[model samples]
Target: MPNAIPTTELYLIAMAIIFCVPYLIWRLGRTDYFAPLVVVQIVTGILLGPGVLGAIFPDYYQFVFTKDVIQSLNGLAWWAVMLFVWLAGIELDLGEAWKQRRESAVTAGMALGMPLVFGSLAALALIQFPGWIGEKAQSWQFVLGIGMAAAVTALPILVLLMEKMDILRTPLGQRILRYASLDDIAIWAVLAVVVMDWARLERQAIFIAAFVPACFLFRRFMTRLPERDRWYIALIWLAVVSFGADWCGLHYMVGAFLAGVVMDHHWFDRDKLDTLRHNVLLVMMPVFFLSTGLRTSWEVGGAVVFLAAGFLLAMQILGKQAGVHLAGRLLGWKRGEASVIGWLLQTKALIEIIFATVLLDKGIITSATFTALLLMALASTMLTVPIVTPKLQRMRELISRDA
Candidate 1:
């Protein structure tokens, strides 16, 4: 036993696999056109996870991903995800959404609503079968959790995709951002409802009651600090708020998002903030992807899981397109414009995975459910650029449309 490799070495080995595998696939396979590096990392995480690697080579999987190594990785993944969610929160631009309230509200509402309905129906079907609902989850919780997962739009991923297509700064990109930003807020709001625990009602009440005044003071304090100090203080605030939320059973991620929402983006240099986000993704988020992959399971049967994913993917794509196309008819969008926007908005990469992780952590969804959702997210994201590029080509003017 004493001659065994140290846990530290094993952990480093796991880290090396997590980073190297995805980069090699993404670079050599040249999947950036269809699956960006981030998407490749996510898929790599799944392939490296227990269901694939562990099933194929049980001893090797266990040797590298020892309990200790996984624990260490989870610790890092927790902070990595919290920081990523925090950045997403800060990037929300409600002010611009307000300027185009009518159009934004209609589009965001329908876009979110249709998917919620379709996904909830899918969840209902899932729960009718065995192995989908979690033990601790109420019927309502499972339904709503899956529903919101389908409805979510990954704003940060959308930004990256749009930038790659040279539309991030264009008027069309700005409009899509506004719609997605609004939906982002709604996604968390619905999540708070899903995670609501009557047993912890008093604790959640206290957290909310305290959080408001604390946010006010935190904002005031942040305004007084110089840029250098503000960065340090913000991290401290994220930890404190996240702890409070988790302590009250609302989940630390809910706290992380709220921690970012109250702070003005102007507090930090935009370039510096962007760099931090990139660096976090570069250095830490791969661990999160791997950690997420580790959670994937086929206990319900692999075929069943894939079937569920396929059904959910159809619901997601159909729901999103139907909703946006309806909005286009109402608002007089040009021909094929809704197709471009609908496809763009349907890009769910990191955020949906994060949402599914929270559900699994809270026992609202089984690992089978999580695996299906993960597959659905991966498919949806990979389909975005390939499908949208041609649509954009056919309707170039839509790219320049401001309203």
Candidate 2:
């Protein structure tokens, strides 16, 4: 039988419209204020959810964003995350990072190792936090998970921050970008293992390992074809590879990411890549971000909420700084340079936030902790834009003086 139209559709419908409106304003070149756009989405989501407005109008809330509907929303959220991750992977040309192997390794180490260790340790202090939101868990596990979430680097945000600060062309900026790129690679691979869609992971690892080699091998075999035809044929094969990755359990995004990386060394028209990105911005990302904000809860917070938020932010800052200092010493790099790298990697994003939620659903963590963790990520990304650029500039001053 054809399914009846869900009455709960309206709440979701409201969510989409409210969240996208600000993003649209930002996109139309009307707002220099970008962070507020994301904040509004998060706030509006809380305002309309059962946590607040729904409490006053029980029937109205249930009629729209019912349990079933919310469940569906949650499912779609993860899918969007997977796609986001895939797109994230596609953004960096992994092979290029491989060429700068030692620097890249050092950069990745300083970027991830610091925040991770500190965040986890700090999280241990938070494991016993009491809360009724999210599926709850022991303090230690909760802290460990929260620690990872706080330490994460949001690659997309870092790129935006770079352009916003007009530092993209600077020597230091290039190095940070390279560091950010390396962080993206490590984070994505870590996510694959931790988030646990094994089928996807297995297939994804194979594609990533095989992609560069297979592409070159195919290039040699297709040597007889006209250059134009050979390239397009390979693109088709790339799409097939993307499809294969999707089918294997990773999501089509991992496939798309692999496809993009494989094509990086190819001499494609620059306009084509721009067009592809344009289309994605026009449609997919808006949908993804809007959908994410719609699920945020504003009313479910309390006094401890502030504590959770503050702790996470502090950890992100101090932990990353410590990481940079440690890594710089180990790699025989200067303290200032290492600090710049640390600041750059302090931002978190959709991947970590979404992963925590996934863990919450499985009862591995409590709702209070998860909610606190999500806030930690939002704060990490939102705050880094203001913190990193200025701090790095100061570092440069110190460096020039030392020189």
Q: Please name the candidate that would achieve the greatest TM-score relative to the true structure.
A: 1
Weakest ten-residue segment in model 1 by summed lDDT = 394-403
Q: Compute the lDDT of residue 237 as modeled in candidate 1.
A: 94
The whole-model lDDT of each prediction reads: 0.94, 0.60
Clashing pairs in 1: none
Q: How far out, in Å, is residue 86 in model 1? A: 0.4
TM-score of each: 0.98, 0.70
Steric overlap count per candidate: 0, 14
